[model samples]
Target: MSGTVGPSAAQKRNYYLIVLSMISMFVTTSTIYMVFPLFFEEYGMSGTSIGFLISVGTFAGIVSSIIAGKYSDSHGRKPILFAGVAIYAVVFFLFAFMEKSFTMFAILRFIEGFAFYMTPVAITTMVADIFPPKQRGKAMSLYTMS
Candidate 1:
């Protein structure tokens, strides 16, 4: 009686969840992306410095994703996702009060990247958990498009 039980249609796919996840990601990313140059200029950073700031965040994300992926496995997906989102919101809100210190902004950007990485890690893991092996690829594609 313990052979296996593949996802039986309903549990294997959830269009609403995928779409909502995508929309949420879009809003978060766009909010920062659309004002990249102006934000840096107002903060008095040169182009090279701005680029460096972005690079720091990218590098941090690489490290963060590896650690978060492992942590998510043991801690469960929902908590990671929630924490990530919460941290992300707090970081963005802090921007309003951030001083004109490039160093501070760079550090926060790195933190933002780390927190944001958790979202996708948790989401993809949650998707795989819900979908059957056979449908996983397709589900992933749909999620990615979102």
Candidate 2:
């Protein structure tokens, strides 16, 4: 029940967590961005179509961020985080096997965008939970910087 507990200890713990979260975020974001380029040549996707696909995903992320943020603020964070990750993993696996179709890709990207925001909202909430008010800004800055 008890361990080395102090402000510095908590800060060190959170610093590591934030670093890991940032790495996760980078990988996810890179995957989302790279998917378009990786498949475009093989799938014969035009630049315009790829642009549209990315735009739709970005738009969906914006909407999902707002909705998920509000929803998580009211409800607990774990459920939303779990649901989001589940949706993301399922959709990503499906996308890997699905036939190349713009319509299907668009739908998948939309869903992915929605689920992706969950990680950010959840991690941010977790960071807030761990850090006090005065330290939260610095913690978040470190999270983003990493």
Candidate 3:
């Protein structure tokens, strides 16, 4: 038998899927960053309030990334990744119809941030799972560049 060993075909497929999902996630995230302030302004939210909303989401992201990374190690990556995408889709849809309640928006922002960070943390862990140790650096480099 040949001596070289690498990721199996299924692993390679999963790696590609993770890359594509991350690309889509990044696109959706950037779109939200661009559009959210304008959307909030159209509803008459003050600049400070808008900034606070963003800050709340960012803080949630920070907290959730830590929790989700550890959780993924024990619970598995795909479930958390899929849950994150689902939560993002639901929260994004909710944003369209949100009224002027700071509490409601804050809750959504926190959840959105939690959902957003879940994707990358799980995806990163998955990339680590897919490639062998010697190949991981290159795999992660390509994954990040994608």
Ranking by TM-score: 3, 1, 2
Q: Tell me the whole-model lDDT of each prediction, alpha carbons only.
A: 0.78, 0.76, 0.85
Which is better, 1 or 3, measured by TM-score? 3
How many clashes does each candidate structure show, in the order listed? Answer: 0, 0, 0
Residue-by-residue lDDT tens digits, candidate 3, 19-90: 887888789878878987777877688888888988998999999999998899899999889999999999
lDDT of 1 by residue, 1-146 (tens): 11235555555445456557657866878877888788877877887897898898888888878977998899898788888888888988887689878878888899888888877888888877876677678878877877
Compute the lDDT for candidate 2: 0.76
lDDT of 2 by residue, 8-96 (tens): 67657755865785587568667756765877788888889889988887898899888888888899766777788788879888887
lDDT of 3 at 72: 93
TM-score of each: 0.84, 0.78, 0.88
- For model 2, state the Cα shift of residue 108 in Å: 0.6
